[model samples]
Target: METQDSHVNSDETKDPGAATYGNFINYYTFNPPENRLGLIPEALLENLGLDSGDEPVLMLDVGCNSGDLSVALYKHLLGKNASGSKLHLLGFDLDQDLILRAEASNPFPRNIQFIPLDITDDAESQICLSSYLEKHKRSRFHLCTCFAVTMWVHLNHGDTGFKSLLARLASLSDYLLLEAQPWKCYRSAARRLRKLGRSDFDHFKALEIRGDMAAHAGQHLEKHCSMELMQSFGNTSWDRSLLLFRRR
Candidate 1:
């Protein structure tokens, strides 16, 4: 199998365009341990029946900023099972700087790769992901993790936009780990928009994304995509819930 290195060593100058997204490096470096979004690789291994180890486990981490969480998951997986089982982690992020930083900081260069691509763009996402899969000779993703990303899409593109993204994700992985933000967060974002003299509820009004944003997303996934919620974990400090879903 052919492996492509997507890491680029650029001058550590911050791009002005990326300022609106906040400081990615500081966020990852200063992220609280309590808020760490850790994935249970053993649970995934047992659930997928890959415990005996037939082939390498292919995992995707969407919106993986700075790749800290991806590294943690990879380490946990290897720590739990040091047998013949192999883990291949692919992390995708829209920020080029974050991708660069992730690649630079990654200790296990061969086991993990970071790609800079906007998953919201269907054609671009498909092409980039498909090319990677083809290069690696993988059929489908065994597990996929999406954290702290859907709410942004929901705020910017509305409910339909978020659902479309979810559908695309479903096609890529059999098991999904999603973090759902509540309506309060959306309202808080609206408040920020109002402060900036921008219309706050336009997307919400258009998509009817009112009341319990988290529940709305969960319901949509269950009804439209036939995804069953296996388990849910909550972080009261962040006011978010991590939901585990399996295709039915």
Candidate 2:
């Protein structure tokens, strides 16, 4: 419900780009205004096959750092469909501290729940997400948004790891909104990995020159998972793209 600026002191936090590694709160506080992020809920709602009056829409936010964007999106959806559509939002992150902060700060606790989850881990993701879906009587997630998480998986697990992560994400959700970072930003990710003393840092470089990184990744997703890109939004400042995909 509250804007990210209202929740944290942006002036006090250092620029996210300058930090070698930082927590979710640091990133949320200092990151530039991402107006495109707010467009996700509307996009999902428009494409959701269910009628507005039929059933509650289920949405998932993967790697939902500090829950700022998730909460804002929840409010936006509620505002658009006041009487007809009910939304149940679930936000997952690997950071327990961030989840705790999200719970503490959430204004609409009844409408949303934040859980510490590693969606890339097979057993953990299956057990946790399956249980939740079972409880809700849902077959698949109506919409899933993953922002700036691919690079982390790639840097840690390499190309194979990233694709596996994408496959899992695609399997869980009917529609996916992904933010893909360009190859130029690979150096920064490598630096972050190095700061953490990672021995596998060279993996990122190997994956860098695939050519028009976002398109290359999208092609891979299309071929492997049958996901087709619906629309794309460019963020020139960051050399990143926000892509919306539908499972084919």
After TM-score superposition, what is the CA distance of residue 38 in candidate 2 from its true location, in Å? 5.7
Off by over 4 Å in 1: 1-23, 37-42, 80-85, 193-205
Residues 1-248, candidate 1: write the lDDT tens digits: 00022232121112211222222444444453236434243456666675565666788998887788788777766674443347788998887777888899997887788988777788998988988777768756888888767766776667778888788777788788887667776666566556545456547557676777667767877888878787776553576777888888
lDDT tens digits, residues 57-172, model 2?
A: 78898878788878877766566554334678899887777788889998777668899877667899899998888888987888888777776667556788788888987888
What's the lDDT of the predicted structure labeled candidate 1?
A: 0.68
- Best-performing candidate as measured by TM-score: 2
Q: List ranges where model 2 is wrong by over 4 Å.
A: 1-22, 38-44, 47-51, 80-85, 192-202, 205-209
Return the clash pairs for model 2, or none. none
RMSD of each: 6.0, 5.1
TM-score of 1: 0.80
Clashing pairs in 1: none
Total clashing pairs in model 1: 0
Evaluated at residue 95, the lDDT of candidate 2 is 70
